[model samples]
Target chain A: MERLLFDLSIAIERGKENETSPYPPDLKGKPGAYEFTSRLLEMNCPPDTILKQGMMPGMDRIGKKFADGIVFIPEILIAAKAMKAAMTLLKPYFDNGAVLRKGKVIIGTVAGDLHDIGKNIVCMVLEGAGWEVFDLGVDVTKEKFLASLNEHPESIICMSALLTTTMREMEKSVTTIKQAFPQTKIYLGGAPLTSDFADKIGADGYFPDPHSLSKHLTGNL
Target chain B: MINKTFRFSTESLLPDISLILIEMGYSIPLADHYLSDLINDTLQQVRKHTRVQAGFIMLPKDSIKTQSNILFENRLLFEPGSIIMSQLQNVTSLAVFLATLGSDFDLWIKFVQQIDMLQAFVIDTIGSLMVEKAVDLLEEQISMQAMIRAEKCTNRFSPGYCQWLVDEQHQLFHLLPADFDWVKLQPSCLMTPLKSISGIIGLGKNVIKIPYHCAFCDNKSCYRRLKNRKGQ
Candidate 1:
């Protein structure tokens, strides 16, 4: 049973989806995450164990590789793909309180920046790391962020923007939100921002990559 | 926004994952083959579903200045205000433009949600690459047009680059021809295609040579800036 869990982790790390998935050719005909996860559940393995042991570690390994530049976005994407496949079967258990989330986060792209890849990647990494993320979609305004923040006061607020154009919006949103909820910790992520910018914006943290953000979520930041 | 029916050009370039990875600081040889294949597959999927359209209009040089969110035909008015775009003293004209990978890409992203999130991410990255390529193509074509006028073109500068504010995006979009179905801009300046871009290009003789694009920006962790700093 332990070996099966290990196999599940390996399959996820390799991005092998199932027997028919052409990815990682060596695992081509072998059972992928889908098959392994189903089998593990059938074995009466605890849902949390499958997630913590099987998916999280696999995602954690890849997440580290990704942050260190040992892996690229595509590899991260595939790994995320595999992990999500397994997570789908585990969702019911999670919803039923059989498993507990690491924490919760409210994240979005600040208004005027319609980009979402960065947000999507960050959310995926966070969720894989065991956080429940409330994703506020693109062009999200400051009011929207405040609304979500008010509703999920326990959730960390993470804002993202891809363009320098929208940095002002990010700054504006942060300033307003910080003033209104000075106790709420805010984090900023984007392609055109720096730690200095985060400091300037009065943010609690600046995650250079989703891995670091995950670490922050895990209290490692 | 300067309205005009001036001539321009449009083109598209597919994303190259190998090169994209290199930009992300991964040497070509160090790139994972499986990952490369997956990104390429995602690009192909986006390409299959994408309808790319990008074009730029070359407005004749005018007295350009800005005041109260308005360019005085010669003023360097910033979108969010107080950004010196650059030395446009000799900028005889501006190439206002728009580019998009189309709504199909948006539909594809939404569709991928029910399928796979990772693939969706890849597709999203591909769309961004497409928009960049489209802008690159637009700038190149604009440069050629400048050459025909016996003028040199400054490196393309968008509404939010350097000192320009993103708030100026709507102003630039209003200059494109009516019925320009390719891309649409919102009151907030967000483009519809999600992978769309709109900005200005300086065309002239001896327009100020731009310093490295990194000098004026704050995103110190950008891969482009990182690669540039590493002397790549």
Candidate 2:
């Protein structure tokens, strides 16, 4: 069982979705995250344990490599793909309360910003790290954020913006959301964003990449 | 004003996979078959969804005007900050350019996002490179045309970079012809069809093309910065 878990972690780290996946040539033709996860489930391994041990570690490894600039988006993305394959089989367990996520996060590109690539990447990384993410998509206004917050109360908020002009919308949304949920942590990401700007705008954090954000979310940073 | 448009088939503007990989953060050689296959598959999809619509207009030197942040024709006030103004101060003319992979690419990316986020991301990166490549081709044509008149081209500058307020895109749009239909700017100045680029390139005898100016710009995550990163 431990060997299978270790194999699953390696599969997720290398982006092996299944036995036939041709990625990470070194691991090609081997049983992947999907198969290892299936085997773990058949052995009655708890879904939470599989997620915490088999999946998160792999994701955490890739995320750290990404933060360190040792791995890039393609690598992180493939790892996320492998993790998603495993998550598909475990979704039922999560829905049935057998598996628990780390926390809830609501994310979006601030109003007037149409770019979602960065926001989507963060959402995937957060989900892979076991956060239940609520994606608000692009051009999300303050009203929409508050509405979503009302629905998913106590959830952390993450906002993205690619344009300096649209950053004002982020500030407005941050101010509005903070007013309604003062304790709700809000994080910002984007090309134009900075830690100083995050501080200036009353945001809790600013992460340049998804890995750092995940680390902070998991209290590993 | 000299205005021209082009509609290149997707085959002509296909971005180099190596360059795309570099932009995606891979510094090593292209030995990863997974990314290779994905990029190939995505390029196939790109061919189906992309039709590059690009064009440019050149405004005469006298028609151009400037101040601290720079102004065009005593109209469009561009707050492009000192970095861009200092470079543009020597330009004899300005070439406003627009390029897009069209609505099909946007629609395809959205559709794929619902099914496969990884593919969507790959396609998004490729689309960015494609649009920039289209602009590069257009710039080449502009350069060739300008060379006939003994003029040179400087690096293109967009409103969202070099401290230029993105809202100035609205003003830039006004300088184009009424029927200039290659791309559209939203009320927020975010270009529609998503994978689109609009900007100004300096044209003159004294204007010199500054290489790798990303170091001078603050937008750390700019796509060009990643593409131009050392070893990439």
DockQ of each: 0.49, 0.60
lDDT of 2 by residue, B1-232 (tens): 7888888778878877787877676676566545788888888877888878888888875666666755566765567887788777667678888888889999998898888777888898899888888988988988987897688888888888777778889878877655466567877788888888889988878776777466677666565665577464
Share of the reference A-B contacts seen in candidate 2: 0.62
Q: CAPRI band of model 1?
A: acceptable
Most TM-score-accurate candidate? 2
Q: What is candidate 2's lDDT per residue for A1-221, written digit by digit as tens? A: 99999989999988898998777788878899999999999999999989989999998898888888888777787898899999999999989999888889999998888888778878888998899999998999999999999999979999999887888888899999889899899999987678999999999989989989998888932
Q: Model 1 lDDT vs. the true structure?
A: 0.74
Q: Per-residue lDDT tens digits of candidate 1, residues B99-156? A: 7777888999878865776567666666666678877777777777878777776666
List fnat per candidate, in order: 0.62, 0.62
Candidate 2 clashes between residue pairs 3 or more apart in a chain or in different chains: none
Judge candidate 2 against the unseen true structure and give its global Cα lDDT, from 0 to 1.
Answer: 0.84
After superposition, which runs of candidate 2 have C-alpha atoms over 4 Å from their true positions?
Answer: B73-76, B205-212, B215-223, B230-232
lDDT score, candidate 2, position B2 = 84
Lowest lDDT sum, 10 consecutive residues, model 2 chain A, at A212-221
Tens digits of lDDT, candidate 1, A15-123: 8877788777677788999899999999999999999898888888888888887777667767777877788999999899999998788999988777776788788
